[model samples]
Target chain A: MAKGEEAAKQLPKVLVLRPPPMFKMFEKEFSEKFQFLKAWESPIPTDQFLAAEASSIEAMLTSGSRPVTADILCHLPSVRIIVTSSIGVYHIDLQECRRRGIAVAAGGDVVSEDVADTAVALLIDVMRRISASDGYVRGALWPIKGEYPLGSKASNCDILVICCALTDQTHHMINKQVLAALGKEGVILNIARGSIIDEKELVRCLVQGEIAGAGLDVFENEPEVPREFFAMDNVVLSPHRAVSTEESSRAKFELISGNLEAFFSNKPFLSRVNIDE
Target chain B: MAKGEEAAKQLPKVLVLRPPPMFKMFEKEFSEKFQFLKAWESPIPTDQFLAAEASSIEAMLTSGSRPVTADILCHLPSVRIIVTSSIGVYHIDLQECRRRGIAVAAGGDVVSEDVADTAVALLIDVMRRISASDGYVRGALWPIKGEYPLGSKASNCDILVICCALTDQTHHMINKQVLAALGKEGVILNIARGSIIDEKELVRCLVQGEIAGAGLDVFENEPEVPREFFAMDNVVLSPHRAVSTEESSRAKFELISGNLEAFFSNKPFLSRVNIDE
Candidate 1:
């Protein structure tokens, strides 16, 4: 056996879960170098799969879709590292990972600019009705009736943005710096994420019509949205899909691959999440 | 009277009609210096309002909302010039103005970049489904039922822009240079005005799906869009409303003001459509 193979066999088999295209690319790169690389299909139930694979697995790769659970961590006594390919670890039970002395790594800052660009694009599209108009044209509906009663004009309008307040970094990511840049020509709509914005202030602005329109992608509640938001025609809401870009996927995969590589080498992982443990 | 007032009084009265906010600003400016300035309501029909007013008018200030017709030019024997505050003279009969020796001036290139920015924003929104998601969230619907399916992200997707074929300058404005910049990450979708693009070639690219998606604001026949265009979901269409920004209205007013000032003094107008006239 090659020195790398023997070394990997002596350690633990690393199981990288299905990631976006970027993840796959990174996995391919790691697999070429590492002997014990196994990638699992996505949407695997944590309990069932972790129970079967935990004993032999030393490291596991995952994303937002396949969150690591406390129960699953309990089964994987040999697992020393948990790597997520995304910045947000809300899905991963970090406390449990810490208790088990598993290192964690995630993708961050690498994809922020791309996500911000997408957010701006999304805001402009919603304001201009670009997609609906495109839908009409593709359907052969020329002179798209009711499409341009007022027409798609941006210079006369204001814009609002609502985001989550989870951390100082996320706050700075979507705060006055970004908002002010966007607000030079339009109004801003930031509803607190406690770490990102203040809710009461945002509501006051919305209720008073301080902005011409708003673009919202996050909320305090996971699955619930405010009822008052429905009456406004100027607002646009997104269910927090802005950062879920292909670029993010690739960045995430790289994080996962790097974590697995570090764990087997008994070196500190790059994105170590539970450092205390 | 001041020299400006003396000149304005000697010239026959001109009625300049526009919407409220813009009209208010222009009226205030004109009323202070010119005795001939008469501001009227917008959306004035061709035959009754514009033609009737044209009889006594030496000049007419109009906007995109009203079409300055050949018949009106014919009726306005004293009319020396037709000044519009808009870049597009599509509503005015340029051929008639030239034939009748009626000078015409318009606003151009003042806000092309702004419009381009808006166009790109719309394209991103449609492709990413930003508005649809917004609607879902505002409606108190969480976990947006029809989320954008995970696939190739915008960075990976090709973009197409269908536009017109105008002057070499305008040609340059939306040419391969601009396309290369925007398409650095995607593709170009130009298919509206022959003045902006080559139709047959663009259609071929669309058919082949060389570009993953397109944003078409203008058409070859205009008002008579092709049937085949309706078949694609990846395409976004704007019924040629790309330039209808709030700034366009103000830009039009300034263009008209310059033309009017030039006509009364026999000085050369800034955007004189025909020097021969």
Candidate 2:
């Protein structure tokens, strides 16, 4: 037998629905342990590819961006386990996984410290205008304009930080009334999912100078942030990257590899998602 | 006596060379307790003003921006106390103050919390490129440019934070060798004085990409930062505003008032600087 075929036959199969962010960089290292059946590399439609590999495939790996819906799962009859390199499993149909008796594992608390650090960074960024003042200095305005205007004393302390999971109950939790109570001097920071805030109301509040400012990582319709925020200096915008760090990425790779190894060896899984809920 | 005279007679006399920042906001409130001898408001020269008011002025109030040279002190023989609304008293002649036996008061630990907050804010801003990403989003680059390139992941660890006071022994303490030691991935944050780091060597290091980046609040010269820093997105520049928050300003005002009141009442000074060194 050819060496490639021999290696493929000996290694356990793991289907990759889509590559996660920074996945390509670690592909060679991962290929040694598990033969990743890449659906994206196939010319056939995803459903056709899944149907062709139905009998052979028993587990899959996916990213946060791809949806693992019921329709997508229907093609993979023999699949028993799925692993995603993301903390949020909102894209995965938990009910469908539960119905099929399929197990799931996700990124664990590796990102918690980085996310907390981001929260403070964003909070201070919005409240103290650190980002804005940096711009002012970079724009060469300091020489002409003298001292940058005073920023709100954030350490004087009136702040709201959002880090809750996105759920039906949590949608639009930070609405107008809560914002009103937070008042004109208050600042808000969101490292959680964007839909948790009423973005429209937030835009209106910012436009009318009701709330002080915001530092946001995620948005309701991401990659399409509210254009109004572009002109405002008080607000600091991030491209949904609060949890992304080199250290966290390394930890995630370890966890994903560990979970896959445990599943193959019939051991207890690390970071298994309880799909019954 | 007239009503104004009656009030002035009961109030304590204090001399002001130039007003502290935000002085106008609290001028009326301050005037109620102390009779301020405004030298800047005089038509005569500052020396003439000081010469004229030498006997009546027992205490002088100054800001961080203005200098209190030995020449100025020569004209204020009766001035027993100097109260400055600033954390750093480098502008005041400490040796002169000591020789004349005049006690000096400054804006002490009031700004410590705010300054520390700024240190973290700048650190994350540079490491995560929060400000740069905000600018990219604002410039409408997200859709066209795809994802903003990944920042160095400041939470990935390596960092240097400079928060020590600048003294004769500490000037240019963070020179080329230190920057070299910090190396390619290390980011440096300076919330201390500008002269503590060799600005020329820093510019060379940054331009050559020897070190990762910097977050600077103070500069080598007041109102004059090295022009090279303006172009580097890795650097976060602040116009010496780490201590200018409103809450700290209020604290500073209270401290200044307390110090002046104590000096007049023959009581212990608050935040008195031991200028013997």
Best by lDDT: 2
Query: Taking the tens digit of each residue's C-alpha lDDT, what string does model 1 give over B48-72?
Result: 6655655667777776556777665
Model 1: CAPRI class: acceptable
The residue ranges of model 2 lying beyond 4 angstroms of the native Cα positions read: A1-6, A41-44, A52-55, A154-157, B41-45, B52-56, B149-158
Clashes of each: 39, 0
State the lDDT of candidate 1 residue by residue for A1-277, as single tens digits. 8986666666546665545335545655666645443446535574567667557677776665566788767767787776766666666787787776677777656666656765676566555645445445544565545334333454455555544425435643544345444443465543333235544444445576543456566655545666666665555556666665666656665666666677777777777653462
What's chain A's TM-score in each predicted model? 0.62, 0.94
- Residues B119-202 of candidate 2: C-alpha lDDT, one tens digit per residue: 989998888888887887788777778666666566455799988877777899999999999998889999988889999999
Tell me the TM-score of chain B in each candidate: 0.61, 0.94
Worst 10 residues of 2 chain B by lDDT: B148-157
Local accuracy of candidate 2 as per-residue lDDT tens digits, A1-277: 9998798788888999888875775777788889888898999999988888755688899987788999989988888999998888888988899999999999889888778878888888887888888888888788888877777676554688988888778999999999888888778899988999999999999999998899999898877899999889889998888877777777788888889989999999999987777
